[model samples]
Target: MRGNILQKSFIALQWKTSFTSQYLVAPTQVIKSMNVGNIRFIADAKNSGSKLEATVFQDDHHRDGRWWNISTEWKVACSFVVAVTSFFLNARYERIQVQKEIKLNRIQSQIKDLYGPLYGNRLVSDTSYRAVMKSHKGLKKYLSEARRKKDAEMIHCWRSYVWNVLYPLDKAAVDLILNNAHLIAQGEFPKEFEQLLMHAARMEFVMESWKNDDGALESAKRFDDDDYLEVSNASGLIFRTQILTHVKQKYDTLRDEQKQILLDISSDKQADDILAKIYQKVTHQDL
Candidate 1:
């Protein structure tokens, strides 16, 4: 009985070893089964280059008698396999979600006419907006030099549309000047006249360049400089004040056509002749 038990244990060990080896070489090969009483042994061919065999012997007459013999050729085989299902899932779904978010932000920025509206209008700030406008200086200079009609028309349209949006802010600057005109005109000489005159010219230039000429004219007409005289008694001392006075008088007294002609031409004999007379009368200065 003891000998039989020992034989079965040895057979089991041999079977396990054989199964492991066979799997290590070729995992797909089916195992063959051998039975002895209540015990079973399995084996498969591995590494076909070498012909090997294993066998187990049993005694039917002796109830407690058995012996086994096995060889490496019958061992099972296996190979390493890596399943990367999680890697594919992460790439196809998780990474795609991140890419989608970035694309959405980019589209939003383009639509808003800002480089990054979601980022608090970082690229659309006043400084950056002005910088972008300044970039068109090259294009404008090129078009002017080339004198291409199509390019000129395109440039004009771009400038017009830009002023449409920016003119309101420009008008606000004039309002600031109008508000502080008294303080500025009353202050020190040379400095005060320079500042006030610059303010006045800036206002006029903005109004002239604004999209709606009639509207800008009407808006500009709303500011009254009569009180400006109260700020300074030395109005005759500075040429800037005289120039501002000349411009105001022209705007106030001239017909629409005459005003347009004066604004349009840099040097017009007729327009200058008329302005010269007005300048002599209002400011008591020769043009």
Candidate 2:
């Protein structure tokens, strides 16, 4: 019975040692395999993270390039607008300057036409005199023909010549004759003196007839009744010429006493007043 008990105890101890070794060895192998799998998973996760970062960097680079292109286009558009506006403004300024020049040229041309060539020369020579006489004769012939034909248009056309040319000539002739009265008394006359006298007589007759004409008389009456005082250059010239002619004619007819009174008048205003009185006295009407 003691031998059987010793053998059974040894078998029990062997069984316990075998069971402990099996369990411990299986757990150690499983832990090693799980560690290897975990290491592979960590490596794969690192690779995926690197790929995502590269993609994000590429996207940022593309956006930057697009923004740079847009900025370049905006600059180009601004430059184009400035260029067009500058060109337009410069063209407009040039056009205005051209128009101003044209207007100035027109005004100069008008002035040259109206007051140059004949009247602009201060010294009158024999050639100028002949030219003037020829012009006057032609104008007179034209005027007479127009009147004979009762051509209203032709008469209207001659109005400027009648005032600017014929009237001025008449005034000049009257002045020459009055100034050279002593030479005339000595039986000396200027060149074309007879022609001037003839013209003067014709002008006097024409003026008298015109003043008495129905239309002229009515116009004169209306002009006299108006209170307007504006004086044109032409009208002022005519008035001055008439006053001088009247004064010269009256002076020639004055007595020695009246002439002495006129000579003694110191100021132009006093002389004009005395002459006006003399005119009233001689004409039996206020002058």
Candidate 3:
């Protein structure tokens, strides 16, 4: 009886050991991850407090979702900031460019008033005119350099008027000038046309000496330097010649009424009217 009781107690002890070990030991291969529940909890959780704390430990999806939201908000804010900054910068740039163009046009008008497009005739003090002309030319070069550096859109604004003025002698511009002159001088040249004629004649007379072969070569050579290349070069002469010649031809072809207007424009000495007429004669486009 004693031996049977001892044997039974030993059997019970073995079963308890086996059961405890089985409870502690994990399966050889994992059927599902323990973290899967935590992941689902964060993904589907709607409660803010539980999501904020418990979801913090979840996979990148939850963490990244939050980060993405914050990032998106920042990106939107940054976009708005950039847009406002661009608006002010563009406005300031436009204001500056417009002011520059206006200043240049004003200076050009003043120059016409002073010289009436004649080289020797002086209206303003030489110093004043020269100063203004220098400014105009300098500003033009500045704007051009800026455009070359990628500020073209800003500098040009609605149109390329700056580009047009800077390159007045370009083929297209020249064509425009000639065509305008023809129209303005169409029927009976205006007094403005007469003034244009006088100006053309004077220029022709002044440039006559440069037409001499010996003098031509010398004058051409003088234009080789940067300073002289602008207005004194052979190419410049040719360009001006074409313009003046066209104006003269147009003037000569004008009808009787146009001719009378030209005479009156010349004799009146009114700079504004004279220039307006000259502009019409030269470019056809209203200033």
Q: Estimate the TM-score for candidate 1.
A: 0.22
Candidate 2 global CA lDDT score: 0.42
Off-target runs (Cα >4 Å) in candidate 2 are 1-64, 117-287
The residue-by-residue lDDT of candidate 1 on 1-287, one tens digit each, is 64786487566655656576753453334344445543333434455544333344443524443322222222321111123664675478556556655644443333233211212322132344455547555333433432433333443443444355433433443454445443222133334335544644554444353334455322322323321121211112223334344334433333343344444443444666897788689776533
Instruction: Go through the candidates in order and give each one's C-alpha lDDT.
Output: 0.40, 0.42, 0.40
Q: Candidate 3 residues 119-216, lDDT tens each?
A: 22211222332463465454345445444554433333312331223222233333333444433322454454344444444444434433446644
Q: How far does residue 128 in candidate 3 sit from its true spot (Å)?
A: 23
Please list all clashing residue pairs in model 2, or write none if there are none: none
Expressed as tens digits, the lDDT of each residue in 240-268 for candidate 2 is 22333433343343333334434443354
User: Which is superior by TM-score, 1 or 2?
Assistant: 2
Q: Which has the greatest lDDT?
A: 2
Residues forming the 10-long window of minimal summed lDDT in candidate 1: 226-235
lDDT of candidate model 1 versus the reference: 0.40
The per-residue C-alpha lDDT of model 3 at residue 126 equals: 29
Worst 10 residues of 3 by lDDT: 47-56
